[model samples]
Target: MAITRRHLLQGGAVAAMAPALGLNTNVSAIGTAHAQSAPDGLKWRHGVSTFGDIKYPADFKRYDYVNPDAPKGGVVRMFELGTFDNFNLVVDGLKGSLADGVRLISETLTTRSLDEPSTAYGLLAEAAAYPDDFSYVIYRLRAAARWHDGKPVTSDDVIYSFEVMKKNSPMYSTYYQHIVKAEQVGDREIKFTFDGPGNRELPSIAGELPVLPKHWWEGNDPQGRKRDVTATTLEIPLGSGPYRVKEFVASRSVVLERVPDYWGKDVPVSVGKNNFEQIRYEFFRDDTVGREAFKGDQLDWFTERSGKQWSTAYDFPAVSDKRVIKEKFVNSSSGGMQGYAFNLRRPLFADVRLRRAFNFAYDWETSDRLLSNGEYHRDNSYFDGIAEFMATGLPEGAELKILESLRDKVPAELFTTPYKNPVGGNDDAARNNLREATRLLKEAGFETRDRKLVDAAGQPVSVEFLSQAQGDERSILFYKPYLERLGITVNIRTVDSVQYQNRLRSFDFDIVTTVWGQSLSPGNEQRDFFGSESADRPGSRNIPGIKNPAVDALIERIIFAKDRADLVASCKALDRVLLWNAYVVPQFAGGFQRAARWDRFSRPEPLPKYGVSGFPTLWWWDTAKAAKTGGRS
Candidate 1:
């Protein structure tokens, strides 16, 4: 559940869309559906769901997970790993590094509930209406919704925001590709029309659109220069959300002060969130330095990623004295694939056998033991940890039927074999795996010449493991020797975060360790992750350049699925195909979130089922605890 640049830039605007069958069904008996008739024969509801009924009703006081009485007045100092150069989300992937926490300044049409798997409650929009076909969705803005400058948020603002995001951001462009047009259908309502019907998730996807102030962007900046939404700028942009940029020193640090007169403060969805009076983010070169800063009280909270550090590095006086709290929060979410993703764009990785050989060469057992202190689980599926979506013990039932239909497009091995990672805990297992890797390499037109792997064109098979974190280098260096034994020249190239993102944007690496975090409900976003169209896009998340027709077909199945059963079956089928193809050398997954923080905050008991640590969202500053721990109050 580590938030990456992709997750931060995308924001929470892409909530799960409901299936096609549930569109027109009246849910008045279910308490909170709030279904009403629209002029276009569509049904307007208070919320949207993917495959089930919405959790909260129209008159619900607040989310069940939050404490309405929780006091919220303290400064929370957090840390970001790299520098940021852009505050413009519209140009996020195309132009510069997006500043962390910028998403807090804007509000999405519908805000997803942390307790629900795939349901979103109205935030900016009071209600959303869509036809049974789901060809288009119309959102009615809240009368209370206003910009920071006190202007009413109109349909024109929503239309302009969607148009600018789709045109300027490659990520958004791909994410919203199915939506063909957006227009003002009412004074307070904006309609997003799709290319065709039957896409259940379109309504929620459209509802997730982040509304920006149209007049502010069209007007001039304080310096009298016309602002360009497509370009990056340091000038603090206009916002309507709970927080605004209070101060900053470029990339080094940023402070966001809570808007005391925020328009949405009294809204039900905003009742128990945005607790911090002043939220500050201090940027560091990497996590290692950030950990030391946390120990010195430079930051108030830290989420530890390295298992080894979580085990041994927090033996400081503050921790032993109970001034610092270290705990693990259960993560009941999809443990999506995180691995050394092979760049298929490279000619060296074009052959499936070669990619399979690399997987065999990765001694994950020994690497886990050394690097993580045996605190990680080997990832075997694209949808690991989600048993319903994970393909196991060979495909069967609906999953088998789905794969059988794609037999001509997918690998034959997918039907007969159950995908699993290579095991290598002992020397015997290590040698056996290495021998298999060598055999696969030979079959893929590679041969050992003078203690080096050479291809048919007499070129050595050299791969640079591009990385940005020192922790990643530790694992890469450990796996480098095993590949070297196969006569492969492995190079570990560690770069700064800015350079690393640039390389990824341009596809300028042989292999890189990246993560694809999955939600319980997977839909249109899958296209950006693995579809053929995103393979060539400059800033799309299809980082490995996957262009399989079978993968594309499976993604459509998941998007247009009719029910929970169909979605699960389609995801399992897609998982099996991706695993058999070996697009990435499988890595490890942590079942819980490891976090350390100063003991100055308190949260409601029984946290939300999905949000691992509510942190600044559900937790509030405790004056007595802050005094005891010497934390900011």
Candidate 2:
């Protein structure tokens, strides 16, 4: 059952036979399938498998779901955790979602652009006008905006949100840390002054800044609340969003019913949305039982990770009759990269050749076939999706334009450096790369003796791959074999979520197979992952403990970039630098997202892109249409 990246690549050759033997007729043929069954006692069962708490309505679709009827009645059961033991609020990574549920009830001055047109627009603030000078950011709050408690939202409240967040959540406070002052100019207008060009980026920053109520807690402390606040259920909390907490039952469920009189109900963003009258989130201790709940109609939607379950589970006769739908979206990895990362601070992994050696030794194609069921595409460059620098082969003019745009941020030498062209299969590239790695190891003062890579002291070079116990069995199996051929001994140990975080914080493991979410803006925020100063910090994501002057400098260039071209160039440069350093072994990117949902609901008009959450901002769920699906409760 154990597999490594090498095994997966090797298995790809065998997996190709599926079509030859008439095995894989379509997506449903080789993998387990899923579908909704007859409704049980629960109205809807929306289940999911996640390692962390289910903080909905924040970044997730909970904010997208709306009940048009505005019914005072039903509950929308959901699955997720309340808090992760190793939770962090740093701007770079996953912490933003933790505070999302609360954010759903609250309002921010601005909200980041999801699609294209309104990339950085105001939410609480009516308008954010930036003049050509871009000296100061003028924030205009909507006069109609008010807290759920009916208190008017004003400039003072906006100022207070900044003050409280800076003192309470420093990790998430990176946006406002540079603000000089926020002065109320008029009844509905406020101005935030920054040092220089920082003001030009105010729209981008202000859009993400969530507004807090100034009058709610005049004297209550922000930090003290974060440390002492542990509520298993709904404690009286007020928000300025569309929904308010109705009830909370610890370890059982939580319900949030829509506010009938939510302000700005007719706003462009609010139109034709909020289909669900009430949204409920429920918890389950096990994934199998969770899947069963969906089959029993305890949930409405579910996303499964196990290809085995997808290929096998849906055949239940109950599911067959219901006509539940199974769907897959491509290039939907959400910029997530899953690979083997080494702690560069360790001496054994200091050599770039060793890292490349590992890259050549392990095979991504094979890993996908065996573990992911051939549902993934191996990635070469770090840039995925719309990032412009991802082009592998370019002509002279295009190369010049790209180079000219990136010259200020990346090294000039990169113009001549060849792009890592797409790899087709187990070919000569691997052999040449292995030979190159061997040469680099020799040059770096290492040699293979007695079939083992050892330093001058003759100490064997070894690495321990730390992983979470839940679903890393396949990842461990995929990596072990390739490491063996490189004269490196691999040790994989699966630890619980909490234990894994604890060890990662201390840099106790040599290597870790982890997920790094590539953001729309990729820049210096990566400090948490590869920065020198963040190495020992418990919350910092920089597990590699890599400290390179070149990397640090490039990170600064990318973050402070003024335009998209510069940003892309910096990213390409950074990607090349990281690849040259061999800090991470590139793995699979652009994988499939498989989810099963009831076919009752229908999309209205324009469908949102793949990365968007299906919610109030995107579509309306029609109960009448859903009822016609012939499902028995």
Candidate 3:
């Protein structure tokens, strides 16, 4: 079955973002029997896909959703939540924020089409070639590709960028973990060889590698300090993308000017995108001030992430006079889980019984009404509302067959029972939930002593809910008391964005509110999000610290499934196990993106299928509308 935006409208957390990436293959490691290669040479193509065929053929012009002739002018001013002190995006200890358009200044080997479900067209690489089993793949770089300094991008630069990323960033290292090596095969060809055959997402993951400039990072900074790839620095890096850092004021603002002579400006994937003449990002300390800035004309676009604000806050005169536009765009994203994640690393939440108790104690119904104006729905599964991938009803058929293989290891009820969230909104239901929670805690070897839930060692069951913004705890405040009824101590920790990232990377909190963004085509990134290996790695998306061996096997199954049928079955099986285990107290997600923007810009008639909204990317300035309402004044 095809997943659509309508299904995602009911997704938990990923209802608002673009999501993908991969992990260790579970299929038996490459062995002698699978050592076959192509007869003559690899076949070259303009794009690549995992389960489906490439949507656009080799000779297609621009993507169907973009306007090839969309005029580009005017500035798009936006806001970033916190401060930035580093220009290095993939480095560790990158405590400060990086410029928003940093990636715009650099080009990836392949660029994805927003309208398609699973596709990535060649960007810097004119063509991609691979053998039958996908053991090795080669990219033919376009000779026309040049750096911001007019230097040709060479094979050495690609090799150097891959080597540095694998060495410096844990994410890139894991994402590209299966790629055994990268070697220059031809004058313009870069080949990435994998450890084995049959893992399909490897080629695309390699294609997503951001090709960095070897010369600039290897050179000295303006202050004459030796450049270090592992360390954070303020040196403006050179790029070959649509935008260049025009200027910047540290921790305050950044302005990027469009590159008139960008090497890939006319590339099929680049058409009608990055249309803004200039992109400005102003840093703000609070969401309230930032929203006010949009109303005050200090900013041009503001996407409302808060449901409360979306319901009652956009009643300003600008909206009344039609100077500001308030609308919701239905997204086609294959969403992932967002919820109060239990740090399974914490001793208090180690037991599945205790985790179930915590879930039972959460009053999502009352909290949704109080905090989100009842415009949200609680998440029921890790991959909730994600088309056919989500595990629902009772597991059967191929999903059951897969689960049968690990019957002894997984939860026995997973084979027979459907996962459901605890229900509670009023006092009577709340009391029933409390009683069930108490029963579950007792079964988990915890007891109520002095009205406090304690372990065998008499240590109180305490949880700290970590959030980047204090205002985000509106729902948490309602959840806190219910847990308290079960004699569980709850603490809500509010930290700045930078600090929150640091703490999350270190796995320093007991419980954190986080989301694992998903895409329609789920692949290797699932490993990073839930694989046992990622549980221990710092900076990984496995915030709940899952380390189940069954999960590791399931992830490999999802990554190596031969076709769409196999992929869907494996994913459904994985979702069931995760949901039954209860690693998170699933939160609510909005059906559509409640966005507020100035009336000065216009988007293409049809927006991209698998995205939140093509803002400041596919949307361009309307000169007539801008004249009536000042744009980026």
Candidate 4:
């Protein structure tokens, strides 16, 4: 059955109606596979589903529906990988994602809605105005907003955030490339003028800009700040967000305490949220102990690794009776691409036929069954929606130009007239592709001898799949059988997350599987992931080392797209080109989020557009009802 955005939005309503309507939507047993069923519930214990998270019972579960009219006081414990680094809030660092996630803890702006296309709305900025030239955008902050320490936030903070981040962080250059200058109009207003031709990406700016406290950072030039990082311990700066960092344990843990005087305490967006009286983020070495701790009620949430344990391991009668309510939030199909990335720098993989042969030999369905327990979906296109952009049809306008350009760069056989839109990966089709690959191998000075793929120098063709040690079991399992069939031995090497990151930074892998989630704006950064410049550079996300001029041009077209429709069409064309080249054997796209949480919280009649959890950051706890039910442990 085709899954739609409407179907995803109706998820909770459909789930609620199931029992009353006598429908058992037991997706537990997906397809022909039998999955373990949950027993009748006692009380659902609140928990998070994360890999290797520290276990703590103090995490609170606040529902969206039950607005507990209670005083604002509770610490929200979140699991952190490590200490707060200055580079996180900076735009130039590889660790910007986590920094962005952490910035929500201690910042505020004028607007309440972060989903708006204009960065004009947020807790700190009320409205943003853009000039006709797209040179800059001005943000007006609400005058009444105050930092947690009772200091008023002004334009200085905005400038400081941009300047400091641009000077120190690695990613700042990528996102803040259009900035011309930032001017403070008043204590409550700031104007950011852009210097380039680009649409106003408000959501990305709002999410990316972490409002820094100007008072604390005074006289700290961005250049000076970068050099003044000699101190081993730095005090947590004050901001007007809901949570504040209370303590840091270097490598093991970090704890955040709820701010009693949070500015938006009464706002509906924040009310009855950040429920836990104290949030203790404990870091562990591995998933085995994390699961054990969760089973023993020592942890509140475990994001990943719940699949295998929840299905096969955690079936103890005592644990099963609690009736763990599963929640699945589906949004528009991900803008990010997930697949087996090829190293285009490698000669054998450069040939489209060879790449397609590997993709054809691999049975994604079987691999998914073995790896994800049949709880997955195949990726049809890089853009996974049926929106006009994802809609299947002829590529026109700029898309046509892109396709035409890539025609020769990609294999002629793959994009021939009979199969302009050929669905890749079939056994017979794979054998045909293999035969073609063998021919290409010969052309590239390699020949198959006795079914073995080898170079003219008699060196065996092999590729190593490198991934983060603990989190990449699915990728490892999926490609193992396929590579073997092509007589190309694939070596799967699991390394520590830190090591894996280091290797990616150094471009030291033949093949790798990485999860790429799309930003809300979904702009130029999308193309940069696979662009030639990115492929050759250190610390770039383009691990494939692809350098084709046609691919680069297509990526550029996708970025200059004027609207969502144009963007989608351009992206589809680029996706087709990539697929034809067999640059990456597309893996299963993200399906439903397999998560279990205690039933302490409920949503109002109309959940927000993104569903129960407000866009990633704005989750709260209904303390009054939670207390009545049984307050924080």
TM-score on alpha carbons, each prediction: 0.95, 0.73, 0.93, 0.75
lDDT of 3 by residue, 278-394 (tens): 999887756788888988998988867777788889888899999998988875655667788889887778899989988888888988777778988888766655666789888
Tens digits of per-residue lDDT for model 4, 1-633: 001011111011001000011223221111111122211211111111101121223222333433455433443333333223332344222431132124446554432222211111235654444433344555557576788768887788788777775555434444455565677865565766665655434322433466777776553544466323222223455667777767756445656676777777654445555555456666554566655665554554444433444466566543455533445555433334467787777676766666656665566665555666766667666554333334244455766665776676754643443222223345676466556545655666766667667876798888888865344555576567656756677788876544555576667788887544443234555434667766766555566776778777766665555555455557667666665666677776554454454333444434433332432233444455445434363
Residue 559 displacement in candidate 4 (angstroms): 4.0
Local distance difference test values of all predictions, in order? 0.82, 0.52, 0.77, 0.50
Cα lDDT of candidate 2 equals 0.52
Candidate number that wins on lDDT, 1 or 4: 1
Model 2, range 191-243, lDDT digits (tens) per residue? 77765652234434554556766675453444445322221212345568877
- Residues 111-144 of candidate 1 have per-residue lDDT tens digits of 8777766677889998888777778888889999
RMSD of 2: 12.9
- In candidate 3, stretches whose alpha carbon ends up further than 4 angstroms from where it belongs are 1-40, 92-96
Off by over 4 Å in 1: 1-36
Better of 1 and 2 by TM-score: 1
For model 1, how many clashes? Answer: 1
Instruction: Predict model 3's lDDT versus the native.
Output: 0.77
Residue 302, model 2: lDDT of 61
TM-score: the better of candidates 3 and 4: 3
List the lowest-lDDT window of 10 residues for candidate 2.
Answer: 11-20
